[model samples]
Target: MPTEKQPVNFIESALETLLIEQNALKILSTQIDDRFSQACEIILQCKGRVVVTGMGKSGHIGRKIAATFASTGTPSFFMHPGEAGHGDLGMLVRGDVLIAISNSGKSDEIMMLMPLVKHLGVPLITMSADDSGPMPKNADVALTLGHLQEACPLGLAPTSSTTATLALGDALAIALLEARGFTADDFARSHPAGALGKRLLLHVEHIMHQAEELPKVFPDTPLNEVLYEITDKRLGMTTVVDHENTLLGIFTDGDLRRLLDKEQQFNVHTPVSAVMTKNPSTIKAGMRAVEALQSLRDKKINQFVVVDDENKVIGVISMHDLISAGV
Candidate 1:
């Protein structure tokens, strides 16, 4: 026999679930009070890594929290509770801080390891709902997610609780990051493969053309020769420098166009300095590539001479160079 077709409101149910989870996080925000500060203090004072543990869905969240903390200035790692009993418990040592998560404030795997954790003198921090349980009572500091229900319609799946827990974990990691005075440079050191790291760590000197690659000409160099330098270098501009290579001005393709528009006959024998733009914008070789890109945009220009402290032209940087390098 065929069963009657069931009618369902999937959109309404999804929106309701989002509302439930949203409220849980709002509640979680209010719960970041004294206990949260105390937990930060404990981790700050610890002389070793943070060891996070949880079971099932909580375990999954714990792994991410551990990764966030480790990347954001705190040294941390995640250990599965099931593995802890089988011998991973050795990963925790005296002076280390352990973070255990369970919505019910108790999980048999965590409970089984609690005694050994205590015996090893590891400070325990438990993240859970405020349910009376040994894990909460015995923890050095208990970060309660407070009384809350899952976003799941039947309240059987871990949804709102996990969201709240993840938020709390992020809050803790960022707080520690601020307390430690972590800077972008510090972050880049830990995340060298990320785009942000590249932006902060890369400099003009690392990418700018140097030495003979610079399209340069003497201030009195003939316009025809200057054209050769620009075309050969393919940078669309040629720097005008004196005998000591001190920058005097810049002659670009734009200048050539304007010159031709005004003059009936282009004179190849004219001095390069006669048509060059004097005191052209320049950038130091040590400036960050991203900073250089912003300067290019702000000045409404596409190229800059890489100059030294004495205003001597050393190299050139172009918009194409930065863009091609993913700056």
Candidate 2:
């Protein structure tokens, strides 16, 4: 009689699963060739959205692939194959491209909708294990994942195949992203609620302290009066400008500390220009907040004078403001 099987080491089993899936991905990478490029070209030429569809575990991967494509500059949405048969097929239009994902290239629901897809004249792109199936045969471009052994110990789960499919989807999305010259600002536009959006979209002008909020004084202003301006404005620094508002220099709390530490004599009525830091680093109001933050860090300073075309001090911006504003 056959004996009952003994339990295997849990870590060894896990490692084995990962190794199998890794090997599958290695094989899948080598399979990418002209067919992948053709699929990308079809998508590039599509005037409408790239509609993705799949069934079972493939459906889950399809949803993520569609989302990645959408966020990365490709206009895309996931359409369930089962739902497509029930009038959702109307989502597919003449200018659209349909990408169907099926490990075997023979999902019944996706197969059932092919007639309507063809009638609508939408380009069909199929991803599967091989190019022999009906779905691949009918596709405008067929992308294949090399034959993969399942990572499952019993060789039954969708482990390695799903990993390969997801990787392929990411490859396609990133290729299109580069081909379209997509920028961080473009991605930020699609994700305004995230940290990157705040960095790229927020401008120095939007957050800078301006007008009465700016602590500024003329070259002849008394040192005691300049301190009051810095205190009242709460910006920790004051711009020393000429009568015409052209920036001459700046004085900060740090400057006050260093000056007092070195000098033995007291002079409250000293002209700020005598001690101010001339030609301090400045930024334009139109600069992105992220760049402003970087400037602050690079210069080892707390703030910047926001200048215009003629180096006139229009506003004051600080690292504190950027951090508080989520930049």
Please count the clashing residue pairs in each candidate, in the order shown: 0, 0
Off by over 4 Å in 1: 1-6
Clash-forming residue pairs, model 2: none
Q: How much is the lDDT of residue 133 in candidate 2?
A: 90
What global local distance difference test value does model 1 have?
Answer: 0.91
> lDDT (CA) for every model shown?
0.91, 0.94
> Model 1 misses residue 202 by how many Å?
1.5
Q: Any residue pairs clashing in model 1, and if so which?
A: none
lDDT of 2 at 57: 96
lDDT of 1 by residue, 268-318 (tens): 999998889999999999999999999999999999899999998888999
